[model samples]
Target: MVSTLSRRTLLGGAVALGATGLLAACGRGGSPTSAQPGSGAWTFTDDTGATVTLDARPTRIAGLNDAIASLWNYGVTPVASFGFTGLADDVNFRGKDLTRVTEVGTTYGEIDIEALVAQQPELIVTHAYPKDSSGTLDPQKPLYGFADLKQQQTVAGIAPIVTIAMSGSAADVVERTVEFAQSIGVSQEALEQPRRDYDAARERLRAATASGLSVMAVAAYPGEGVYIAKAPDDPALLSYTELGLNYPDPGGSDYYWQQVSWENILDHRTDVVLYSLRAMSGADMQQQPTFAQLPAAEAGQVFPWEFSAMDYVAQARTINNLAEHLEGSRKVT
Candidate 1:
């Protein structure tokens, strides 16, 4: 188990993250597929618009990107997770310890093809829409075209493919997640509660903010710096905006999360700070050198949110969870 850092250290790291200018390189690799039958079928899609059909609903799934954190909420833990080993290492998403999960790649759009093939995942999940519609494939790594991911499966004779979006917006991720769970026969009842909870939470937050509570959603990582979510105005950042929260300048629209410094956070003096963390314990931030100095921390204004919600449907459930917790001003233990 990794130990949590002191609050000062955590806050200092968050400050550093702002100065260093870090943004998560996350995006789904494919477009939404036409729904079809596949129970326990190994399904997959490549980056090139080709589909690879498999025989079973993948049990040993392999997630190629860090944004797949939503998969866990749906109970779709992969045998291997690219990027960070587990949730603990993830600065944005917390409550997951992927130490048991395989590390497939570092950063979005990059994958360990050889290692992926070795895992022999029954199903391979990746992003497709970002590439198909946006033409925003990572410039650095050779992003796998839909066809490429499929071809890889053909060679290994593994399961088929499934493609979902990673970057459209929070809602896009949520809908895709519901669709995926529905595809696999996850109970509608199981899924519905989270949505309802999210709705209730949203309504509650909006009501609470009527009294005027300033809120900002932030993604803070140690060396990477703090990046605020785009404002809720655009289709993407709409969720948080509905809560009557204010985003630092450059509201939404930045595509990748926007970097913010402690000074910037203080300047805004937001009444609430929604932060993302992966497997962070209360003790972790307490030990950090600079965490307590931050206005949010000093004022007891920070709340921990997981970064795994980049996948939409799962995000909705997570949003609901966050709403339930924060609506009552409940702090994460």
Candidate 2:
């Protein structure tokens, strides 16, 4: 979750826990319960293969903004949520309401631990990557409001945290999210229509990709620079490729993107650019002197790349929108 400095300031915390205790506090565990007939206990195996059990289904859930949106699609809303930088103005969240949900913090680390703890969440849900080679979770990964180790330990002590994996494709993330939703008692019937809609949208994307307009996803930086998304590292981009989209790889071992100066932006030419909505806007890019030199920019073949979309509806919308762009694009490079 990238953000400007104003939106990403780290909040101060006094408490600290040892690394072992921190892992233990954040580790998975569930309690037995008799909340409902045939629903003895709630247990979930997260992306890291950690199992968390709860005595009863979680009614009061806390999550990151994207996770909250995912849960909303399943008719389950979080009691509290944390947002990334510029959250109030985030184009991706347009038309969505976050009024009733308590705000814990922003992506740059402004966590209100007292407020979050006041929510009394039975479960805390957020995205997580697999354990590093050292078999430990990395706080640097965008797991939620816990960007800092001290913050993570402080929050972990408030309630059980369920870290869903973000390393797989968007489809994989959605599937795991669905399972988590089901464990919390969201009905399968509620998911049926969304699944169908997603399938339809996916087919549209496939058909559009058949047009062969080379595409690239990128985010602009302050210093006349751009970060071209490395398809393999981005689940959404990977999913697009799986659907037959010809997104060029920037050819680097970087986890998610290849940073390059704007002077070199045209080196990775494409017919279309999926610009990051979380970063710079179209107008912002237009201000860049070299941006107009890019074929995609000159042709006005830019579309919002909503990399944080988690719900079926949002995913479907993104696919359909990209399909429209692909269908209309002309080969420029």
Candidate 3:
């Protein structure tokens, strides 16, 4: 019930998250253990290099919003969730029934630890970023959504935590999340239709990129400015680029975002704008005094970039919607 802005602190600043051990994170989901359920012991080595061992497969699970939404595609729902998971009209939720899931942390950094503990989850899964907007963690925080390392550790103490990379390629992020889902007794039978949908959607996206639309991704803070993504550094944007999307120059030095005032918003010109829903609605961004003068904004070329949910169903939806936008856009810049 407590929906909030994006906890996508991953793209909030100039911090460069070089790369992560995504393959190592995927090197899990022991078939015997995961497939057989409680018949044998279960163990998973997360991106942080920690091996969480359990006497039996963990049945009750808790996770960050995006992680849980991703798991839902494989029919694995969490008992508790944190972060801004429902920002995009729950489209990333893939029609999964989340009524029973407890909202642990509605925004970022602030977790209702007591509510999470009440769920008695056996395992907690979330993404890992090098640091957050908060400078408290110094060089690295690793855990993605929690306020800092201490909060993440406090939650970890309640239930063993498993992490996947939040700063790698979309495929790597999706794979790690899927592996986590598979490790927790997801039905391979349930994956068939999604596989077909994903393949179709990806091809559609590749084709739509041929529309020659120059798109720029950004998250705007009303009073401050806008943080535009450096395409190669962002997981989803990189994936789109790899699929042949022509994104305008994504300016930034700290690795991901280049903070620019409204006066300089035109520096990153594009035919279409992939704005994050975390900041505000597209309508609100359109209402900005100076933002209204931008060519794409005036041309009604803005689209919601609902940060990643990493699930096949959700990802396919994002791909298809973007493809539709690309196919319909006119180069206003």
Best model number under lDDT: 3
User: What range of 10 consecutive residues in model 2 has the weakest lDDT sum?
Assistant: 7-16
lDDT of 1 by residue, 1-333 (tens): 002221112221210010000112334334433335445443334333345554644457776444355566656667766543334555434665656577766543345677777877866555432322232433222222222334434424554445453444456556656666555545667666767765665576556555455555555555454556555322334555656644445443444345555345444445556664542332454344465555556667677655444443444555565555445542221
How do all models score by TM-score? Answer: 0.58, 0.84, 0.84
lDDT of 2 by residue, 69-174 (tens): 7787677868887766434654445666768678777654567889998999988876654332122445344344455667766777888777765554778777
**CA RMSD per model (angstroms):** 8.8, 5.3, 5.1
lDDT agreement with native, every candidate: 0.47, 0.68, 0.70
- Full-model lDDT, candidate 1: 0.47
Candidate 2: TM-score?
0.84
Off by over 4 Å in 3: 1-7, 10-39, 85-91, 131-142
**CA deviation > 4 Å runs, candidate 1:** 1-50, 55-59, 65-72, 75-77, 87-119, 128-161, 187-190, 219-227, 232-237, 248-266, 276-298, 310-333
In model 3, what are the clashing residue pairs, if there are any?
A: 109-147
User: Candidate 3, residues 87-186: lDDT per residue as tens digits?
Assistant: 3354565455668788877665678989999999999887655432221122343366676657777887999887765655686677667777778878
User: Which whole-number lDDT from 0 to 100 does residue 256 have in model 1?
Assistant: 33
